[model samples]
Target chain A: MALFGSLFCRLVLGLVIAFLFLPILIVLTVSFSSSAVFAFPPPGFSLRWYASLGKADSMLQAVWLSTQIAALSTAISLVLGTLCAIAITRGMIPGAKAVATFMASPLMLPGLVLGIAFLQAARDFGLRDTYSTLLIAHVVITMPFIMRTVLASLSLFDFAMVDAARMLGRSYPAALWTVLVPNILPGFVSGGLFAFIASFDNYPVSIFLVDVRTKTLPIQLLNQVEMSPDPTVAAISALLILGTIAALIVCDRLVGLKRMASI
Target chain B: MTLARDDLAVMPAAAPARWTFDAKALIAVPGLVFMALAFAVPVLMLVGDSFVDRDGFSLAGYRKVLGDPYYIGIIGNSLQLACITTAVCLAVGYPAAWALARIRGAWQVILFALIFLPLTVSIVVKTFGLTIMMRRDGIINFLLVNLGFIERPMRLVFTEFSLYFGMVNVFLPFMILPLYSVMRMLDPRLLDASASLGAGPVHTFLRVTLPLTMPGIIAGGTLVFSISVAAYVTPGLLVGDRFMTMSQVMAKAYLNIRDFQLGASMAVIMLVISAALILASSYLVRTPGGERR
Candidate 1:
């Protein structure tokens, strides 16, 4: 009975995973097809479609812009978010609890609302269509990940070691460098990965703030998917899926998804 | 104890005269400053924009959104869609979480990995995948047609069914995670206690396990409800604007019509509804310390 039940569970779970990933697998397969239209079991496989992607300069530019934005936004968010996390987690402020809740408010707001609000705010400052507009918007969206993970790590941590280091005459910077940094590195890295991906895949804010030159990958993909149902979109999507999976695996290996979930 | 004296001797002469690095003060300064700039300011401006008009503050945009039946209908649809999706998620996810909780170790890791795989993928890409698979000539329809369940292909792609299918698939992990967490903490010896007291398996589940897991159920259900109410992508692509949720309508109001004030009003309404649900669920979560029959 146990054997049968275990097999059943495996089969059901396997089917679910396959269903989750089937379109991505199909997209990759379709990208290699000689045929222009999307179809399973292509007439013959060819690398021409993948090669043709090189000529789609707009798409190429969008991918480049997305990479830049993700990198820049991640950098900015890391600075602000790390400082913010330390302040909230280690502080003895009267309203620290309220401040923690306030920092997490972005996660609850609908994307449409957030995007519209940012667009309006940017316009008031005459900052629309600039790279800084999108970069700032991405930071707001991604900062929550950093704050949430870092706070969780801090809350679960033992402050006794830090006190001992202090009592032993270690400077604040020295203690932080030696003790806190190593302890929190995993959380920060995982959170940073999530932050980058959030910026990379973001469309709601990007669509409102992006210019023709500043489009991110998702906005570019949306444009293509809206205008033309080409298989190359699938190819790009396949690249993104592969990239995201790789990121997750690296994150798991470094910090472990189990730790992330607890946070 | 001797370390306290020895540490005082080694203390740096240039060390500041503060008792310690003020943990509270340190945490507050940066986080509070950043929150004011990035978060509070933007949302406050959003609310302010909703009330202002050509001359000054007015309720015109709010009136426009509230007075229009078409816009009002979207609120009803948003609530209905969220409720139905929450119910379906609970029904499907409860059994799966239950089954997984019964297993352990390497098998447990694999099951968890399967549940979380979808979350790693982009939401837009996932919606696109559903669009392809649920189309008229898609695999699902092809199979159903071949099996003679219907003589002709059914319109599954641009309907509520497809919307629910996409949502349930996308949000399944949210349901499973909370349920799994709660179930893991449940004491299995209680089952033996119930059985020894002459309770059948069904009775044990209803009277014991079900009540114990309500917190997880409530937590997960609230999450699904809040997300579904504000979701635009799945409905926009799959339902194609024929069935509009408040979020979708809000987006259209801003993007298509270029009515920023009206759009902000709709957004404020959506936020209020979500806040109400959160407060209610948190209240439910707190009111009961433990399970009740």
Candidate 2:
């Protein structure tokens, strides 16, 4: 039984590893399929689908809108999350752990629930602006990712450097900038990148908040699949795979993937 | 992940904050107040909406959601899907995480990328990829036929199997990451000690490794269950109208039918279920046998 159990475990894990990569492999394969339809073992190879993305006016617009929301929300979340992290680390707030958990609670709740709540809240508040509402919702969606790493980084940070700097003659702000900022830059960078990606890919909350003009990439991509079953979506996925590789390279250089993944 | 961070939050109270209110602490207020307004108020208002409609304090929505068999089945579907996904993820991820924790150097980086790469790609893309691959003439069907496993293409896409398959794929990383983190901290010597003491592989695992990784199991389990229960895009794209989950019902309620009351009730139930799972998991961690690391 023990041997069986162990073998079973390995077999499942091996299959799972393949399971993780197979769809990605297939998507990459289908993108270059000369066949317009989603046929495996393509009739031939071509970049027609990749070329098609340029003229995919709606997809392009959605990408641009998603980019704007992700960047802005990430910037906003970094500031907000970093401040909260600092306060949690430096402050005497009782149940600061609970507070930290509370800050990250948005993640534990369902996006659909949050979307519904935001929908009702926006209507009740008479917040009619789609772009701003979507942005606000993205901020909520992005917050926990920011908080998790920033807090993790802050916990690992040595604050006595700031105190020593303060004792030497630097003002509090100057002490923080010189000592604290450089030390935690990795955390901020990792957190911000994760936050940006989270916001960019968000669909459920954005779905409720997005009007016709404003839609995130995930929503737009899903619409494309439901509307037009073609290789264009696969090409976009392939590009996204490349983008992720680029991001991974940047992360590996800046902070090392180990540190980023650990957090 | 939060387990260690919970310690981080607790560690600071020993030293400071007793002075005249540190102005630095005020920095946290903006985020807090923003959450209170943007996050808390909205959820509370949603709960309020569930209780009231055009008829000033009505249970009509609750009646429809809880009292109707169809809505009850939808709730069951979400729970069933979440339970199955969490179970599959745990079953598959535990050994992967175990093997991962034991790996060193170059191989770790390669495997890590393989697992984490999909996460970087959007869920829409991942789910879409699954749909494309599961199509009648998709890669999966083609391979199965070529291998003589089946005579011809099977209708695989809009089935319960694909729904579970896609959900497990999406959520497996979440399970593995937490388990990997926890398992990496285990002392290999402990396993050796157990073996030396005549504990067989099963006994060693159950008595030593299993006890040690309980927190990871809970943490990963809670995280997977919470997200999978409320999954929207996965079910919507994979199975579509063939299956009904709470999220789809809520989306239809709010977006299509504009039934705020029904959507709000659904949201409340989901929140309550998630909150219970979180609380239960945390409570498990805080208990004596499952003490925090």
Candidate 3:
């Protein structure tokens, strides 16, 4: 009975995981199919769908735009989040707990709501649907990841090392730059990775804020899925999966899976 | 001469302490500026927009949202859907998280990767895959058909079932992570003690583990609930115009009807409710019934 129970549990778990992932797997297989209409099994295998991606000019543009936005947003999030983490964790703020929650307020709200708010706010500022507008929205949402990871690092950090550096007459900025950042580099890098992925994968915020020229990749994917269900989307999704896998590997190396599990 | 200059610099040590405030100000500068421009100011604008009309602050938007039965139904449906999704996620995620906490070795890495991988993908793409996979000719239907489980494919798309399916899949990781953290911290010897005292595994789990891990349960539940409540794309893409979630309703109000105020009102309501839930959950976790777990 015990063995039976364990087998049943594993089977259920495996099935659920498969259910969650099978769509992308199926899509990737179908993208290589020679048939005009998409199907589960291929009539013949070919690379025509990938070749067709090159022909889809809008997709190419959207991918480019998304890359630019994600890069910029990740950079901004790293800067802001690190600073906020330092401020709150180091007791630079009076009400550190309240301040931390305030910093993470955006997480509680939906992306679509944030997107619309940014859109209306941009209209007011005469920057509607611009790259800067989307960049700002992405920055807001992604900053919390950086803050969370950095905060986790701070919880494990040693203040005595910094005190010793200060006692040796090392300047405050110098102590922080040399002693503090190196120790926390892993968390910072992991946070940056998260920030990049968040910005890249975001759809709801981009949908409201993007224009024809500034449409992000996910937005383009949404448009494509709406108009036509094609295998090229599968190709793009497969590319995204590859990118995510790469990011996960990098994160594991930097922060360790144990730390991530704790997170 | 250099020694004399250094002595002169040392004489002004008092000035350095006075300038320490500048460092504090500098440290505070970046985060404050970013939040103000990107978050606080934008949300404030949405709130402001919700109240104002051509004449001034008016009841026009509120009246339209509240007075219309269709709009009221939309709000009800969104809340109801969110509540159901949250409950289902808790049910599914609790046991899975428990299992993960107990497991070891290669399986742990696989489970961790499996949970985290979905998080890295774009919501649009995930929903798109779900859209295809839940269709009449989709894999689920195909399997059912092949297994002779059903005579005809059920209408799964554009239904609440797909909405819950997608919600549970997307947010299960969130629930699992928290529960796993809490459960791992639990002392296994306590369970052993309970078993030695004639308690069975099920009884020990119910009495000892469940109560002790309630903080994790609350934290994960709140996080999942709030997220599901405000989720737009999954429900929107899966259900389409068949149903209106609060977020989707707000989107349509703003996009299709050109009712900015009404949309803002709905958005504000959703935000307030989500905030309240978070506050309540945090309170529960923090106090844990006025005793530490």
Candidate 4:
């Protein structure tokens, strides 16, 4: 009976994994097809679509814009989120738990709601600049990721080392800079990486904020798919998959995947 | 004696003054202010806008949304879809999560990575992949035809099935991760104890394991349900003009029609529903388990 039970569990796990991976595998396969159309099981294979990526100027510009917003927002959120996390974890404020929950609440809220709210707020406040509006909205989107990971890291951290540094003649600021920062560096790297990716690939929230000349990569790619329905979008998907894998590897090296998942 | 007393008073004053900086609180101010201005205020304004219009404070927006069967039906459909998607995720994810919790070592790492990979990639990319597969001449139809199941390609792209399939693919990880986290921390001794008492595996699971893991189930369910309800990209891309979710409608209200009041009202509804569901689930988890560690 136990053997049979175990076998059933294994079968379920296997099938679920296949379901999760099959679409991505199909995309990868389709990216290398020689055909211009989206036919499965292409007649032959070639890298021509990837080479043709250069002709898509808007897609390239979207990529650059997305990278800039992601990098900037991640950097901003890292510093702000880390400070807030420290305050919460160290019990320096009353109602820290409530604050922490509020900070991370965006993760649970739907991006579409946030998107419309930001649009309304931007219009109401007379914030006409699309780039700044996008950046601000993305900061809200990315802060929760940074706060969660940083808060988790800080909870595991021992602040006695900072006090020790202080007692050893360092100023309080100097102590935190020298001791606390190094210990939580893994959290920063992982948190920042997640934040960057969250902003980079964000679609729902970004779809509303983007203007005629300021489309993000996901929106741009969606537009391309709607317009062309060709291998060019497949090629972009392949590259993004590659980029995500690279980021995961770096995250694993810095902080084990187990820790990342737990957060 | 007088001199010594003055020195003691001065020392107390110096100590309080030195401790007044509150470095931590000072550090937190910037982030708190930012969230308040950017996130909290915007959402509040959205809710506030729902109750007002050009004629001043009114329920016109809410009335329009609730009174009209079209909008009412869309909300009903969104809820129904979310319910079905959550149920499917829980049914399939429970076993998979259990298996993940039981395993260890390299296989665990690889399987977890496999689940996590799609999550990290763009949802557009994943949905696009599904679009390709579900197309008339896509792999699924091609296989079905070649294998003699059908004489020709069938229309599968813009169907409810494809929408559900796309959503389930996108959200399964959310369900599995939460459940797995809880299951991993479950103590093994309780199962052993139940077995020693001659309880069958089924009985043990129903009486002990299931109750204990209810928190995980609630958490995962809430996550899946809320996300599924508010989903726009998958439904938009997959179904296109065939169906309209509240989110897609809300997007159109804001972007195309320039109806901020209607859009804000819809956005407010989604937020309130999501918040209520989360609170209800958390309450359930808390009351039954009484705060499980």
Candidate 5:
């Protein structure tokens, strides 16, 4: 009975893993297909779609815009989130746990609702700049990821190391820079990666905020899928898949996948 | 001189600490203020907008949402879908999460990475992949037809099945990760003790393991339910106009029709339902045995 149970468990795990990976594999395969339509077991294989991606000016612009938003928001979130994590973990702040929870609450809220709320608020406040509004909204979307990972890292950190450095002729800020920074660097990297990806790939929230002049990659890709229904979007997805693998490899190298997932 | 120096060093430590606030706590102020202004205030205004219109404060939006059968049907449909998705995710995620908890080393890391990889990718990409695969000429139908299992392609896409499949695929990791995390912390000795006490594996799991992992199950369920409830992109792409979910209605009202009042009310209703379900789940988990360590 136990053996049978264990076998069943393995089967389920194998199937689930396959389910998770098969779609991505298909997308990658389809991107290489020479066929214009999305057909599996491509009749012929070619890189024409990838080559055509260069000529798709709108797609290129969207990618650039997404990159800028993702990078800037992630950088800003890292700084603010790290400081917030430090204060919550180290300082004798009242309602620290509540503050932590509140900071991370955006992760739980639906993106559509957030987008709607932001739109309403933007209108109410008379904020007309779409670029600045998007940057701010992306920051809101990205901060929670940074805060959650950094807070988790800080919780496991030993403050005595910082004190120990202070005792050994290093000033307080210097001690934090020397001891704390190196220790929590993995958290920063992983958090920043997650934040950047989250911002870059964000769709529902970005959809409401994006104007004709400024559209993100996901929006552009969706538009392409709707308009052209070709392998071009597949090419983009395949590239994204590669990018994700590289990011995961970096994350695994910095702080093992196990640690990254657990948090 | 040595004794005087020792006294001076100790004096700094022994002096009554200034009752002034810890300035380090101020570090969180900027983040707190940002969330307050950008996140909390916006959500609050959204809820407030639902209650107000050109004719002063009113519940007309809610009345419209509730009184109209079409709108009411959307809410019911959303609830049903959310519930079904949550149940399916938990059922499917359990065995995999169990396997993940029991394993260690490289295989575990690889499996963990595989499960989480979807999360890093865009939902649009995943849904698009599903769209390609679920179409009449897509991989599944092609396989089914070629294998002589069916005479012709089946109507798989733009159905409830695809919606459920898309949602479960997207949110399964959320369920599994929490369960796996909790299960990994299980003490082996408890199972041994249960076995030695003459409890069968099933009996032991029912009484010991299940009870202990209830918190994880609750956490996973809440996460899955809330996400499934608010799901827009997958449903939008997969089912399209074939079905109407609250998310679709809300998006149409707000974005297309520009009915902020109607949309805000719908948003508030969705938020309330999600919050209620989550609270109910947590309450159920907590009240049953209270929280185990």
Candidate 6:
């Protein structure tokens, strides 16, 4: 009976893992298919879809826009989140625990609600720039991710090393760079990676903030799926899969995937 | 001599170098100020808008959203979708998380990647992938027919099945990650001790494992529920306009209908529901001690 129970557990685990990977594998296979229309099996294999990605003018624009926003937001969140994380971990605030929770509270809110709020806020302020609105909303979207990992890393960090370095004639900023930064580098790398991905893939918030010209990639890709059924999306998705794999490889080397996942 | 109670509570005995304020605490100010401007103020404005119209203060928006059956039905659909998705995630995610925690080495890496890789990919891509896979002539239909489960291809896309399937597929990681984290921290020796005490495996699980992991279950369940309740993309792509979720209705209100009052009320409703879930879950997670933030 125990053996059977363990077997049942293993069987369920195997099936769930397969279920998770199935759609991704299908997307990859469909991306490489020579057939234009989606089908179970392709008539032949070709790089036609990938080749067609160049002529996708708006899609490329959207990709560039998403990359910029994601990069910018991740950068901003890392600096600000790390400092706030420092304050929380060092007991520098009166309600440190509550402050940490508040910093991460944006993650608890639904994206559509945030989107609506930002929309009304923008209107009230007469802030008509789509780009600026998207960027600002994305900063909020990315901050919690950075805060979570950075706080985890900071709590495990030893600040005495910085104080020791300061005693050794190093300046405060210099001590922070030398002693503090390297110890928590893994958190920064992993947090920044996750934050970048969060901003990159955001849809609900970006949906409200985007104008026709400023549509992010997820919004644009969704529009394509609605307007036209084609492999160009598959081509883009395939490239993104490859990009994600490259990122995973980098993160695994720097911080290890297991550690990153734990955070 | 005369220490303020709030200040005393804030300062732990180990870190008692404070009376006015810790100058280092100012490091958090920029981020706090940013959140106030970007997050807090806007959400407050949304709440304010829900209670007002163009000319003056009004409850017309709430009357429309709360009174109309169509709107109420949409609210019901969102809640139902969220509940089912959260329940499914917890069910599937528990064993998966347990297995992940217990597994080792290469297979563990492989399994973890399978979950984490999809998470790294955009939800749009994942949902889009599901749509393609659920097409009449897609692999799912092909497998179903070939495996003798069905006779012919069915229109699987734009259906409730696809919506739930796509939602679970998208949000399952959020569920699994929390459970896995908690399970990793659980001591396997406790299970061994339970068995040594002559407890049956079922009894050991129920009395020992389940109680310990309740926090994880609550956290993962609430995480999935709150987020999925407000999900716009997965349902939008998988089911389109065939199903009207609160988010879809909210989107239409803002973008197409030009009804900020209606949209703000809907957003406020979502906000209140999610806030209650988050608060309840955290409250439930509190230990016999003060809390575990």
lDDT of 6 by residue, B17-94 (tens): 453346557778999899889999999989999999988899999999999999999999999999999999999989
Candidate 3 residue runs with Cα over 4 Å from true position: A1-8, A163-170, B1-18
Candidate 4 off by > 4 Å: B1-18, B21-24, B146-148, B289-293
Q: Please give each candidate's TM-score.
A: 0.91, 0.93, 0.93, 0.95, 0.94, 0.93
Residues B45-100, model 2: lDDT tens digits: 99999999897999999999999999999999999999999999998899988877
lDDT tens digits, residue span A1-263, model 3: 43564565566566656766775676666677787665444589988888888888988888888888888888888777777788788777678888787777776777878888998988888985477788888889888878888888987889678656766666666777889899998887777777787788887777788776778898889888888878888777777777778877877887786666454
What are the Cα lDDT values of the candidates? 0.77, 0.86, 0.78, 0.88, 0.87, 0.87
Best by TM-score: 4
TM accuracy, model 1: 0.91
- C-alpha lDDT of residue B94 in model 2: 94
Clashes of 2: 0
Clashing pairs in 1: A87-B27, A91-B23, A91-B24, A92-B24
Candidate 6: residue B60 Cα off by (Å): 1.4
Residue-wise lDDT of candidate 4 within A7-72, one digit each (tens)?
787789899999988789889999999998778778789999999999989999999999999999
Minimum summed lDDT over a 10-residue window in model 6 chain B is located at B1-10
Question: Across residues B1-293, which tens digit of lDDT does each residue of candidate 4 receive?
Answer: 34334433566576643453375478899999999999999999889999999999999999999999999998998998899999999999998998888888899999988877778988899999999999887988999999999999999999998988888998999999999999998887988898899999999888888988888999999999999999988888889867788998899998889887888888888998998998898788768463364
DockQ of each: 0.44, 0.57, 0.46, 0.57, 0.57, 0.53
For model 6, the DockQ equals 0.53
* B1-293: candidate 1 lDDT, tens digit per residue: 35455447656754432344453356456656766876678878989989998899999988988899977888899999889989988876776776677778888777777677667677777777777777676666777888988887677888888888888877777787888788888888898799899998778878888899999899889988888888877787778778988887777777789888888899899888888999999899888656643
For all predictions, the C-alpha RMSD in Å is 3.6, 5.4, 2.9, 3.3, 2.9, 5.0
Which scores greater on TM-score, model 4 or model 6? 4
Full candidate order by lDDT, most accurate first? 4, 6, 5, 2, 3, 1
Tens digit per residue, CA lDDT, model 5, B1-293: 34334433665663422222355567678888988999999999999999999999999999999999999999998888889998998898999998888888888877888888888888889888999989887888899899999999998888988888888888899999999989999887888899999999999889998988888999999988898888888889889988899989888997799988999999999888877876798678769483475
Report the CAPRI category for model 2: medium
Q: Which window of 10 residues has the lowest lDDT sum in candidate 5 chain B? A: B14-23
Interface RMSD of 2: 6.6
Evaluate chain B of model 6: give its TM-score: 0.88
